[model samples]
Structure formats: structure tokens, C-alpha cells
Target chain A: MIDGGYQGKILRVNLTDHVVKEEALREDWAKRYIGGRGYGTRIICDEVDPKVDPLAPENKVVIATGPLDGTTAPSSGRVMVITKGPLNGTIACSNAGGYFGPMLKRTGYDMIILEGKSSEPVYLWINKGKVEFRDAKHLWGKLVNESDQLMREETHLEAETMEIGPAGEKMSMIANVMFNGHRASGRTGVGAVVGSKNLKGIVVRGNLGVTVADHDKFAEAVRATREILAQNPVASGGLPLYGTAVLVNIINSTGSMPVRNAQDAYLPEADKISGETLRTRNLVRNEGCSDCSIACGRVTAIKEGKYKGEHGGGPEWESIWSLGAMCGNSDLDAVTMANYLCDRYGLDTISAGSTVACAMELYEKGYMPAKDAPFPLRFGDADAVVESIRAMGEQKDEFGRLLAQGSYRLAEHYGHPELSMSVKKQEFPAYDPRGIKGIGLEYATSNRGACHVRGYTIAAEILSPGLDRLAYEGKAAVTKFLQDLTAALDSTGTCLFTTFGLQAKDLAQLYSAATGFDCDDKEFLKIGERIWNMEKLFNLKSGLTGKDDTLPPRILNEPIPSGPSKGEIEELDKMLGEYYSLRGWGKDSVPTKDRLKDLGLEDLS
Target chain B: MKVLVLEPAKCTGCRACMDACSFEKSGVFNPLDSRVNVITFHEDLMFVPTVCSQCETPYCAQVCPTAALVRNTTTGLVDFLKEKCIGCKQCIVACPWGSIRINHLGKEIIKCDHCSGDPACVKVCKAEALTYVEVEDVVASKQQGVAQTYRRIAAEMVKGVNP
Candidate 1:
């Protein structure tokens, strides 16, 4: 029997058969892989076959929370969704924050695994230990927020719901699952997989309370962490005031903000859409997730104009880069509107915006005629960006259909794959690698595709203020450590922003106090390393090789036209060799047998 | 003597206050057990804290047949005696704010008592949204807020601007 921390139940549901059952959580797995993304990746790797289509019945979607979820620990209201990515055909693990994670954990379950496709639309109602299958045919094809509201009204319970909008129902490769109507488990098309199962949403409500292993010790650790966060400039001052968009000006100042579809590393109009501008022009207030002390979530509003009274969660730094700089649109109002549409329609903004950017480049290059689009699409046209996003979400036109295929396909459709600034078919975020060496290597090797959150070594390479932003040496080791630590942190059911002030040691203490396990910083990092290796194994089994661990041609070959790091191309080959060695992998980037044995993952690779 | 006053504009909707209250009374971390509830209007971008205002004439106390609810003289808060409660749930319906709730065992009513003048929720609120302040000071501060807003609006009008 599980003692504390974990709720000790793993719920499995087969939508095809409408069969639901619970399996005892494996404590050994908890000790080895921890939870959240770690547990989700491991479970999905074991159950889903490498050859199965991500949108097929064989594909499994596992949603897992860690032992620290539902506790008093800061930012513990988060969950991980793991499945085969329909976008890039890679092992995908997406994390989202809101109330859904804690509410799920309070139902006495560590994870919920959904398998098989249903013949018709359905929704799952989970109350404590019982799981009910409710018909959602009427709720099908609704917007994410409308679906959430309808589900709550039908259930007559104050339940936390995660729903996918028409984008997912149409199976757009970049469609995401919206949590609590706003937060998204965005990236890799996890929502498309759920949509393929004909499951519209999952509603959960629980009253059971979580009890910590050592209450006093947990309290002390939590108290100390809050104080530490309060002292950190990024966690307290910057994040609370500007949210994640705080990085817009800083990264731009460092000449690392990717602009105009990677044509430039510096956007001259950056200040027009920067976080400071948002604070004065759009932000209504700062919001937070469950138990979060650092309220970094921004609730914004478009005060006046064509989009007056329009409001939503945010246009984060990535959104600003994608919808603003990347598309050559400097209008914050248009960016904010696009962000809200993406959220409501369950679309991944990075992919959607990058696809539009790619289309813009194609149109400018005369490959795709401007007349073919529903509107006159051009760079710096905020109206075009807004209309294009709406058209894509609705799949209304030929241009919309092409753009829905994401940047890789959209760029290739016009015979210019190089225009798509992506790795492994997933769009790159705001950071330009020419100015940040660690981020480039991290992007190349990230199992889930080109993603900043996977291994945000930029935290040290750029945002640290005093550290070397362009150093290639020792970056391999640092990126490897960060990738592993990020994997561990993602599994802990806490927001990664906590790393700004608290390190692995602090997390270890909190986890130990909550779970009654004495894990140290070194051990925690080792667990993280093991989880990363496990994901690597899954990717390898799915036919990805070391050669796949490379950046896009444009990013690797082109030098920054003009920036602080002008004339610098990514030195990827120099770091990839060192990274492989540091990770204890062969030159082919496959984990060695001995390395697998050490991590108790002998049967993995 | 003081009462819990809420400035909802400053709330982040973190729910730390609920956790603190739940831990104080139930010895566990659960929002369902917390007396103070936070409701968020996502579309409007607002957060409102729901707690007993401790009205001069508490409807919960007046509606009670067995007199289970009574005003505590020291804290100037309504206190519930579970032993005297009949579980009729009149207090639940009578509370306009829906602040009172049934305990986990469903045998008694749970409501805020200001934690005997040192509310756990107020103590944990880092945003200073929930403050324990004197009643007169609360009224004066609200008046000051209105005056400040009026002055800002007048200044904006003088400058030929509208927000």
C-alpha cells in the first residue's frame, strides 16, 4: 500500500469498450522515474508500439501527476500529457498548469490512461474512485471554453475540465488540449490523439484531501522556498510584473530573439510588442495556478479599438515572437487577439504562427500568390495575421487548409522547406540560436522536437545576465544537466519557473518531506537523467537515429544578418559530440547497454 | 478587534489562503475544506474572494432553530457549535455568500470564525488581498480609493483623454 504523496491509483479507460478499471501504482517505478512527464513517458513507451499511428486506436494518451501534486508546494497544480506526437511522429510529453492536475490527484489517482477509439463522441466524469462515461455528442465540435462550461452545467458539479475545440476534432496536427478553458497542453498534437478517440473532454471533481508524510518538515521546506522566490528578481519582481513575456526585451537586447521567420535575430520594432508595452497597453492583472506563490500568468485585455473588451490568458514571449516578430507584425493588439483565438479553438500558437510566417515568406517569394489566400497576406499586416489565424482554426479556405498542415508541410508545399525554422518538424520558439549556443544544441537533441521548454539552457546561456551568452565550450554538459533536471522538474507536478530561485536540492527536500523518501540533489538529478534516457529509448525504437538529433538547415548554416552576435552560425557539430559523451551514449547517440543497466532500464533500448 | 477585508483587485487567485485555512482546521491541504473560497471570472479577468462578511444581523444565526450559530464577542465573528447543529442545512441556504459548508463527516456545519482573531487565510495571503483590519479603517480606505479614482478620471478629462 502506498503511504503518502501518491494517491496510489492508476485509472485505465478503454473508450471503444467503455471499460474502466484501476491498477495499483508501482512504487518501484515511482522511485525510478518519479511522476508527471517521467511516469507518463515511461508508461506510454511500454504500452504504445513504435509502429502505431499516433492517431490510431493503438496510440495511448497518459496523463500523470507527481507525488507533490495537490500539496501545499508552490505551483503544484500541473500535469503532464504523454503520447506519440502526430505533428513530428516523436514521443511527445506536454505539460500544463491550472486546477485540473490537483483536482485529478485529489480523486486518488496518480495517472489516467486512455486507450482505443470510441465510435461516437463521449466525455469522462471522474468523481473520487468512480469513473463514468457520459455521452458528449451534443458537445462535439464546440469551442474549448464552451465545451468546459457545458460539461460543468451537465454534471452540475464544480468540476475541472480539459477539452479540445474544433481544431482537434478536425485533427489538425498542431491542435492542443485546453485545460480549464485557457491553459493549453500545447505542442505535438496531443489533443489530436484524444480527438481521434472521439473523447471530447474529461471532467473531474474530488473532495478527498491529501496528507503529507511529514507535515512539519514539508511546511518548513515550503516556507523556505517562498522566501527564496520572494528574493529572486526573476521569480518575484519580473515574473509577477511581466509574466514569461519578461524575456521579450531581455532576449531581444541580447540579440537572441528570432525575428521575421529567422531572417533576422533582431527586431527593430521589438519594443512595440514587448512585455513593458503589454503591461501598459493590455494587461488587466496577473493570475496564478493552484498554490502558486509566483503568479506569473497574465490576464490581459484589449481596452479599445476593433478588439475592445477582448481578453484572455496571455501572449507569452513565444507568442510575441511567433505572432509578432516572426510574422513581422508589431501590433500587440493583433497578437493578443490571435492568442485568444488559439486558446478558444485549441490551436498551438507556435505552430500556427510559424506556419503563417512560412506562408508569408512563400507569398513574398512568389511561390504562393497572395490572391490564393482569403485575405491579402503580407509581412507587418496585423489584420492579415488575425484573419489568417481564424481561417486556419476554422479550416475555411485552401490557404487555411495548407497552413493547418504546420510550417514544415506548408513550407514544403511551396518547395522551400528551409523557410520553416523547425527541427524534427516542430516549430522553433522565440530564441535565436546564433546568440545562444546552448539553446541550439538543446533544440537539436530535444526528443519532443524543437521546443524551448524541454531543456531551457537559455536560463544560464542568456537570461542569467552575468553568464556567457555565446559560449560554446562546456555548454554540452550544462545542456545535458538542464535537460535531465527539466525532465525531473516536469515530472514533479510543479511549474518549471520555480527553478529561478529553487534548485534541485530544494525540490528534493520538498519531495522528500512530502513523500517520506530521503532523496538528495544528486539522486534527483540521476532520476531526471534516467527519465531523459527513457524518452531517448522510445524515440530510438520509433526509428529516430542520432542523425535526427540535428537542427534545421537555415539555423545551422545561416549567420545572424545583424545583431550582437552577428556573423555567428550555430556551432552544433562541436557540441553534439561532447553532449553524446556527457550523456554516456554512443557516437550514434544511442544509450549504451551499461548506461541502461545503471539506470535499471535494461529492457528499454 | 478586526475583520477580514478583501481587496479583490490585488488577488492573484493562487488559492494559498484556502490551503492555509484547510491545514489550520482540517490538518490537511484541501480547498474543499477551506472556509474562504476564491471564484475567478476568467472572461472578465477578475477574482473575488467569498467569505462571511460577518453582518451585524447574521442570517445564518437568525435562521438557525437550535441557535447553533452565535456571534463570538471577542472576535466579532459568527461561531458554529457543531454539537448543537441539527444538520437541517438552513444555515447553508441562508448564507447569501455560501460561506458555510458541511464538514467532511457531513455531521456539522463549517464556517469562518476569523480563527479567533488571527485568520490563517489572511496570514498566508502574500498579495495582501485578504487583510485583517479595523472596520472603520476599511470604510475609510474604500472612500479613499473612490476619491483617488475620481481624481484620476478628472485629470484624464482635463487632458482630453478617455480610458
Candidate 2:
């Protein structure tokens, strides 16, 4: 039996059969996987057929939280949405921060397994121990904010919600599950999977207390951890003051801010869309997730513009870069507006913006016909960017329909898949791999495909005690270590930002105190390695091979045009080979049998 | 006497105070069990942390037939005596700010007793949205804040006229 940090219950809902079953959480699995992404993905690997179509009825979605969730641990309110992602056909786990995860845990369940497709639109109302399938026909096509309000009204007033918007209802490949109508589990088409199941949303409220095994020890651990966070310049200063868009100018200065579909890595006017600019012009207030101290979330409004009076959660650094510089548009207002629309529409801003950037590139190159676009789809056309997002969200026209399919499909349709700036058919985030080499490898090998949160080597490559961003040497080991560490960290139901001040030992201390596990830093990272190898096995079973572990040709071939890291190109091959060896994987990037045995994951393999 | 003062403008809606309070009181983390609460107004971009005012003439103390709820003169706290509570929710209803609540188990009334003088909520609030301060200081701070705002507005008006 688990001592603490868990509700010790799992809710399995079969939509097709209209069955809601409650089972004891598998203590064995909890012990090994920890929780959140690790525990959720383990369930997927065990239950889901790797070869199953991601959007099919056979596929399942696991909504999971860690032992630390709802606890005093700093920034511990992350929810992981795990599934076979439609976007890249990979094992996808998108982590989101909001009250939802903690609220779900309070409902006496650590995880919710959504299986089979509902015949009609429906939402789950989980009020403590009781679960009900509520008809959501009225909420089917509503925006996330509207749905959130309606869900609250239908359930408890204080109920937390996770919902998909019109984009998800239409099964847009770039759709994401929006928590509290703003925070997004925003990658790899988790929302499309929900839509395919006709699951509109989930409303949860609970009054139960979450206790830790060693309460005083846990409190002490939290105090120490929070102190570290308070002292760290990035965690206490940059993040809270400027929000995440603080990275806009920082990354640009590194000459790795992907611009104009990554045709350029730098933009001279990048500061116009930066965090400092956002604060001065658009910031309404700073917001934060449950139990967070950093308060990096920005609540912004577009005042005195065409999109004036438009207010919402964020244009976070990635969103700003994708919607701003990636399309070669420096209009901060347009970017902010576009970000707000994406939130309402429940679209992944990175994918939506990057896809629009891809379309703009295609249009400029004459690959995309002018008649296909609503307006001149040119890079730097702010109006066009906003229009394209609307069209894509609504799937309004033929061009909109194509855009909904994500950049890879859209670019492939235009017979230039190379222009997608993607790995595994998912759009790359803000960073230019040519300028920052390790992240390219990370993007290429991320289990969910082209994601940054999986392993943010950028913290090392660009942030404090910086590494040589252009160097190919030592990046492989650094990338592998970070990936393993992040895999474990993401599983802990904590914000990735906490890593700015926290190390494995700090996290392990919190975990041990919470769950009565005597987990050391070394053992903690081993668990991460196990989770990583488990994901690799799942992908391997899903037919993703070492050949698929690659950066886009543009990143590998093209040198950065100009700026601080001018003439730099990602030497991916030099690092990837070393990465494979370090991971105890074969040349084909397949985890060896002996390595699996060592990690005690042989049974999984 | 020190009272729990809240600055809604400084609150980021993190609910750390709630967690800290709940853990301190009940040895668990649950907002439902917390004496302090952070109410979020998402559209307005505001968060207001609410707690027991420990009113000078407490309505909860006034309404209690059993005198289970009484204001402690020393601490300025409207303390809830559980043995005498009788599971009566009169204190909960009497609380104007809804600061008093039933325990998660619905067995008894729970309210802020100022964490026996060193408010746990205030200690955990990194944003400094919550503070335990002398009542006079709260009013003084508010006046100072208002004065600063007026000064800024006056400066802006002068700039407008000069331009």
C-alpha cells in the first residue's frame, strides 16, 4: 500500500459502454513509474496497442497527476495528458499547469483512463467519489472559455475544468486540451484524440485532503526548495517579473530565435515582441498555477488596437516566437491576439503559428496558390497571420482545412515537406537548431516529437553557466542526461521551470517525504532512464526507428544566415551517434536487451 | 493587535497560502480545509485572498448559542472550540466573508485562528499578498498606496498640459 501523496484510486471510464469503474491504483506501478507522465504512459504502454491508430476507438487517453500534486511542493500542479498522438503517431504526453490536476487528485483518483469513443458528445463530471457522464451537446462547438463557464455552471461553481474547443470538435491535428480555458496540454494532438472520442471536457471538484507520509519532513523539503527558487535569479526575478516571454530577447540574443519558418534564426526587430515590450504595452497582471511561487503566467490584453479589449492568459515565449518572429511578423498586438484566439479555439499556438509560417513560406515561394489563401499570405503580414489562425480554427475553407492538418501535411500537400521545419511531422518550437545544437537533437529524439519540455537543454546551452551553443562535442551526453532528468521531472507533476533552481536531489527529497519512498538522486534518475527507455520501446513497437531520429534537412544542411551564431549548422550526426551509444541503444537507436535488463525494463521490452 | 491583511493586487492566485494553511492545521493539503482562500477572477485578471477578519464584534461569536465561537482578547482571534461546536454550521453561515467553513469531513466548523499567532498563510505567500500586521499598518499602507497612485496621475496630467 502507498503511504501517502496519492489518492490510491484510479477511475476507468469506457465511453462506448457508458461504464465508469473505480479501481485501486496499482501500487507496484506507482512505485516504479512515480506518477504523471511516467505512470500515465506506463498505462498506455500496457493497455494500448502501439500500432493502433491514435484517433481510433481502440486508443486511450490517460489524465494523470503525481504524488506531489496538490501538495506544498513548489509549482506542483501539472497534469499530464498521455496518449498515442495523432500529430506524429508517437507516444505523447503533454503536461499542463492549472488547478485541474490538483482538483482531480482531490476527487480521490490519481489517474483517469478514457477508453473507447462516445457515440454522442459528453463530458465527465467528477465530484469527489461520484462520477457522472453528462450530455455535452450544448458544449460541442463552444470556445474553451465558454465551455469552462458552462461546465462550472452545470457542475459546482468552483469546479476546475479541462476542455477542447471548436478546433478539437473538428478534430484539428494541432488541437490541444485547454485547462481553465488558458493553460494547454499543447502538443501532439491530444485534443484531437479527445474529440475523436467525443469527450468535450471534464469538470472536477473535491473536498478531500491530500496528506504526505512525513508531513514535517515534506514541509521542510518544500521550505528549502522554495528558498532555492526565491534565490535563483531566473526563477525569482526574470520569470516572475517578465513572465516566460522574457526568453524572447534572451533567445534572440543567442541568435537562435527561429524566424520566417526558420529560414532565418534572427530578427532585428525581435525586441518589439519581447517580454519587456509585452509588460509595458499589453500585460494585465501576472498569474500562476496552483501552489506556484514563480507566477510566470502572464495575463495580457491587446489595448488600443484592431484587436483591442482582447484579454487572455498569455503569449508565452514559445507562442510569441511562433506567432511573432517565426512568420516574420514583429507586430506584438497581432501575436498577442493570435495567442488569445488559439487559447479560445483550444489550438496549440506553436503548431498553429508554425503551420501558418510554413504556409506563408509556401505562398511566397509560389508553391501555394494565391487563390488558396484568404489574403496575401506573406511573411510579416500581421492581418494574414490572424486571419489564417481564425480560418484554421474554424476550418473555414480549403486552405483552412489543409492548415488544420498541421504544417507537415500542409507542406507535404504542397510537395515541399522539407519546408515544414519539423521532426516526425510536428512543427519545431521557437529555437533554431542550427544556432543551439543540443536542442535540435532533443527535438529530433523527443518521444512526443519536436517538443522542448521533454528536455530543455536550452537552460544549459543559453542560460546561466552557458555551454558553447555551436559546439557538437559533449552535447550528446548533456542532451541524454537532461532528457533522462526531464523525463523524471515531468513525471513529478511539477512545472519544468522549477528546474532553474532545483536539481534531482531536491526533487527526490520532496518525493521521498511525500510518498515514504527512500529515493536518492541516483535512484531518481534511474527511474527517469526507465521511463525514457519505456517510451523508446513503445515508439519502436510503433515502427519508429533510428532513421526517424533525425533533424529536418534544413537544420542539418543550412547554415544560419547571420547574427551571433552566423554560419553555424547543427552537426546532428556527430552528436546523434554518441547519443545512441550513451543511451545503451544500438546504432539504429533501439534500446539493447542488456540495457533493458539493467534498468529492469526487460519485461516492458 | 496583528490582523491578517490581504493585498489582492499582489496575489497571483497560486493558492500557496491555502496549501500552507491546510497543511499547518489539518496535516494535509486541501483548499477545502484551508482557513485562507484565494478567489480567482480570470476574466478580470484578479485574485483576492480572503481570510477571517477576526472582527471586533464578530457575528460568529454573537450567533453562537453554545459560545463555542468566541473572540480571544489576547490574540484578537475568533477561536472555534470544537468540543462545544456540536457540528453546528451557524458560524459558517454567520461569516460575512465565508471565511469559516465545515471541515472536509463535514464534522466540525473550521476557521482561521491566526495559526496560533504566526499565520502560516502569511509565511508561505511569496508574493507578499498576505501579511500579519498591526491593524494600523494596514490602513497606513493603503493610504500610502493611494497617495502614490494620485501622485502618478497628477504627474501624468501635468505632462499632458505641458505637452
Candidate 3:
């Protein structure tokens, strides 16, 4: 336990043998990994064989909470679900902000590792020490919400559940495991890994509270983090007020918002799904994930006709842009509805929308016909966006099956892979990297394909928090620094939002206080660097090359059609060299001997 | 009549109250064991918080076979008298809110005693959903909120706002 916090035991569930084991967490691994995404990625990379098929039962699914979880730590409600991704064919680690992370820790486990496929559909239930696997045949065909309701009814009362939908069961390459009230461990096809194991969901309830190593010290450290957040206008003010949807208009204004399938970097109708619109129209309430004072999770509603009586979850900035502008659809209700459908179907809305947007481009260029597709699928058709989301979930029709595989493959199937926007096999998030040069390099170098959370360079390039690297000249250095810092934060089990309010050193203090390790500040940054390198090493071992570290053709070649960033295509090669130089990598992008030695990884190979 | 003054609209569903109650009573984050509880009854993604409404002429205290509960003379708040109390769970059966709980109590009836006036539930409420208010003022604001919602709908309809 953190001197006075929760015990550091990982609960391992072997579905193949119906065994629940509690393994002691390795302190060294914990020190290096931190928690949540960092810890989860490390575990999956170390335990699961790289050669294993993404959809095979041999791949292990790891879920973990970070160190700051279950405490009074601000925005520490995020949980990470790590696995081999069928979408990118590499390490897939996804995270979502919700109550589940702290709930899992309070449920008396620092992590939950699911291994081996069950012969039949099964859902694991944990109530403190009592654990059991029940036949989930009845829950098999149900949607995420229905599964949760049924599980709660069967369990004799309220239950916190994580359940996959039909997309997951179908092993859709872009599926997700949805939690209560629509929180999700989305993207990178982690749900497919769970689906491959015939695992439906996990239900948990616990009676434990965190105990930090040193109470006064932890309290002091935690207070410092709060102080940092208190000063950060973005976290304490902007996020808590508008949620992430605040980024819609801001990014659009800055020409960073992706529009018309990343071909354009801005859309005029972006205000339709902007945070201002959400506040005036859709927002019902603000909810937080576990331990988060900054309740960024919004409970939204579509109050009018068509999408009325349909609500909950959010059309957050990414979802708003990805489902709205990227698809060439600017209808607010349609964006909200599409997001709702993705959540219910337990699919990654970003990938699902990107996939549909790619399909629309294909259709426009005569790659696929409107009649052959399930709906009158067009770029700006809001109805088509909603229908296609359903089609992806059902996975019955031919095009639906292809769309479920995500954008990269969907475009490849239609003979226009160049039209798809992704780095490494995964679809892109909201930003059009052509506008923000550093972000393009960040996307390319991300271990888990195209992902914004890998390194939120927008903080520097767009927000210009401390230093601005808007141009490509010094972007590589900043990208590497931010990635290392983000990697450290991700591992520390702290919220990225906390960074807006606090610093890396503050987070380090929390870790040291909570764990009673007397962690040096310099060592904390080193921890993040070590975690990033280890994941890179894992991907490298799995046959990824420096060539895989490149953006889509759309990003590299096409000029952004409009906005302040017009005529700019990402200058990736120039930044790549600088990024490599700073990261202590050779020309080939492999970790150098000094780098490996720095992270104490000389014995790892 | 001590009833939980609830503002569902204000509830963030953070469950800080859950931990506060458990920490004081059970020394853990045991929702099952905590005397005071909160639930997020979601409809249209709305968070509805439910807690013990210590009733007047209390159904639970009135029905208890043992004199396990008594009202405070000044606060007029219903409270658990652990002394001269047995773990018969009669109060648990009689309470309408399902707020009365035995919670593994061996020989004492457990209930919210308002933490001697500074209700722990109120102090730590992240959403400010609950308050141990004075009896007469407990419900006026909730009625105002409901009326406001309807007024908003009526106004919006007249404005001819399009979907």
C-alpha cells in the first residue's frame, strides 16, 4: 500500500481456468510505469507475446488505475485498458475519464489483468474478496447499457459494470468497452481483445479507501497540485465550465480543427458543435470521474425533434469535430446522436466517424456507390452519419464489416488508401496536423498509432502554455519534451488536465508522498522517458520500423485548403531528424546505447 | 422531521459523501457499510441522488421494538441511540426511504445523527446535492427549480426555435 494508501496488488483473472489470483506488484515496475496508461502499457508489453494475433485469446487485456486515483487528486478518474490492437497491429492502450479507475483501486486491486479465453461468454464479478464468473449468454447480444442494467438486476442491486457491445463481440477493429453512464476505454481495439476472450464485462464493488505512505507529506504534495490547477485557468476554469467541447471553436479558430476528412483544417459551421452551443443547447449537467474536482464529463441532451429523448455522454471536442466537421456534417443533434450510438454499441466514436468520413470521400470519388452502401452515405449527410454508426455495430452488411475495421483498412479496401488520414494504422483525432507541425510529428512517433493523448503538443503549439513552437524549426525538441513529460504524467497515475493546473514536479511529489519512496524530481522525468522507450522497444520488437513512424499521405502531401494554416502541409522529415537527435536515437530511430543505459534498460534486451 | 434536503440538479455524482460517511463510521470506502448512502439514478443521463430522509413522527424510530432511536431536543432531528439499543433491525424494515440500514451492526441501531449538526454528507458533497437543512426550508428551492424548467419549455416553444 502507499504507506497509508491502497495495497499494490494486481488482481489477475484467468478465464480459461476460472482462477482469480492476486499478484504482488513489482515496486520497480511501479516506479518506472507510474500508473494507468503507463503501467497498463508496460504490463501488456511485458507479458503478452508480440507475435500473438491481435484478436487471439493469447493476447492479454490489462486495466489499471494510476497512483493518484481514489485520493483527493484532481481529475484522477481516468482508467487505462491496454491490449494488442487489431486496428494498428501494435500495442493498443486506451484510457477514459470516469469513476471506474478509483472504483477499481477501492475494489482492492491496483490493476485487473484479464487473460485466456473462456469457452463460453462470461462476466467476472468482484465484491471485495468474493469473486466469481457467471455465464453471460443472456448478456451476449445486449448493447452496453442493457448489459449494465441486466448485470445490476442479476447481481441483486446496483453494480459498476464494464461491458462490450456487439461490435466488441464481433471483434470489430475499433470497438470499445463501455462503462456506466457512457464512460469508455475506447480506441486501439482493446474491446476486440476482450471480445476474443468471450468476456462480456466486469462488475465490481469494494470497501477499501486509499492509504498513502505519508499522510502529511501526501496532503502537502496533493495541495501543491491543487495549487497548480488553481492557477491554471484552463483546468479550474475553462474545462470545468465548458468541458473539452471548448476546444471546438478554439481549435477551429486556430485552424487546427480537422474538417472534411482532414483535407481542410477549419470549418465555418464548427460553432454548431462548439462548447458555447453545447452550453446553450445540449448540456444537462457536469459529472466527474472518480476523485476529479474538475468535472469535465458532461451529461448532454438533444432537447428537440429527431434526436430528442436521446442523450447522455458527450459530444466532446474530438467527438464533435470527428463526427461533425470531419464527416462534412455540421448538425449538432446529428453529432450528439452519432456519439450516443457509438457509446451504446461499445465502439470508438473517433474511429467510427473517421471510417465513415473516409467512406464518404470514397463514395464521392466513385470508389463506393450510395446504393451499394447501407445508407445514402454522403459527406455532409447527418442521417448517413447516424445510420453508418449503427451499420458498423451490426456488422452484418459487407460495407458495414469493412467500416468496422476502421479508416485505414476501409480506404485500402476501396482502393484509395491515400484518402484515409491516420499515422500507423489508427485514425486521427480532432486536430489537422498539417496546421500544427509539432502534432504531426507527435502522431507519427506515437507507439499506438495516430493518437492525440500520446503527446498533447497542442498545449505548446496552440495554447502556447509556457513555450510556443508554432513553426517546425524547434517543434521536434518541444514534441520530445512534451511526450516525455506526458509519458511521465500518464505513468504517475495523474490526470493530464492536472498539468494545466500543476507541473511535472508537483506530480512527482504526489508519487513520492503517496508511495513514500522519496522520489527525486529528476528521476520522475527519467521514469517517463523510460516508459516511452520501453513501449518503443516493444513495438520495435514487434517488427515496426522507422518507416511506420510516418503520417498519412494526406498529412504529408496535401495543403490545408482554408483558414490561417492554409497552404501548409506538415514538414515531417525536417522535424523527424531533430526529434530523433533530441531523443538520443540514431538515424534509424532505434534507441541508442546511451539512451538504453540512461533508463537502466541495458539488461532488458 | 429531519429529511435529506436534496438538489438533484446540483448533484455531480462524485460520491464524496460516500467516502466521508464510510471513513467516519467504517474507516473505509464501504458503500455497503456506510449508514448514509447516495445513488446516481440516471435518466436521460441525469444524476438523481437519494439519501436518508430522517422522517418526522419517524416511521423507523416509531416502529423500533427497542428504544434504539431518539429525537434531539433542540435540533428535532432523529438520531440513533447506540446505548440501550439492540441490533433488531426493526427501523430498517419500517423506513420508507430504505435509508435505515443495519450495516452489520451487532447490537446497536445505526442512523444519521447529523454528525451533531455539521452533517458529514453536506461538508464533503462535491455536487452540493445534500444538506441537513432546517425542516421548513428543506423543500422550497426544489419546487422553484421544477417550475423554472416548465417555464423554460413554455418560453422556448413560444420563441419558435427550430431543431
- Highest DockQ against the true fold, candidate: 2
Docking class of 1: medium
Q: How well is each residue in A1-605 modelled by candidate 2, as lDDT tens digits?
A: 78899999999999998899998888787878899999999999999999999999999999999999999799999999999999989999998998999999999999999999999999999998798999999999999999998898888878899999999989999999999879999999899999999999999999888989998899999999999999999999999999999999999998899999988899999889999999999998888898999999998888987888888899899999999999999999999999988999989999999999999999999999988888999999999999899999998789888999999999999999999988998998999989898999999889888988888889999887768888888888888888888888888899999999999999999999999988999988999999999999999999998888888888888988988878888888989989999999999999999999999897888
Q: Give a tens-digit lDDT track for model 1, residues A116-181.
A: 999999999998668999999998878887898888888744688889998898888889988888
Residue range with the least summed lDDT across 10 consecutive positions in model 3 chain A: A462-471
- True-contact fraction in model 3 equals 0.36
lDDT of 2 by residue, B1-163 (tens): 8888888988999998999998998898989888888898755668999988889899988999999999888877888888887766777788788988777787768888887778888877889999888989889988998999989889988889633
Worst 10 residues of 2 chain A by lDDT: A464-473
lDDT of 3 by residue, A1-605 (tens): 34544467999999899998998887777766777667787787778888788887788988887776766655666778888788877877787776677777767798999999999999988876578999999899788888887887787355577889999999999999787738887888888889999999988776566666776676566556656666677876788688899899888887878887887888988887788888889898888765566677788888997989887788778888888999999898999999989988898988888988999888888888767786667789999999999889998899789899998888888788887888787888988888878888889999899888878888877774554434778788778877888887776566777776566677778888777776676878788888788888878878889999898887888888888788888879988988988899988989999889988777654
| lDDT preference between candidates 1 and 2, better one | 2
Computed on C-alpha atoms, the DockQ of candidate 2 is 0.77
Pairs clashing within candidate 2: none
Candidates sorted by TM-score, descending order? 2, 1, 3
Would you estimate the TM-scores of all the predictions?
0.96, 0.98, 0.91
Predicted candidate 3, C-alpha RMSD? 3.6
Off by over 4 Å in 2: B147-163
**TM-score: the better of candidates 2 and 3:** 2
Determine the iRMS, in angstroms, of model 1: 1.5
For each candidate, the alpha-carbon lDDT, in order, equals: 0.87, 0.91, 0.78
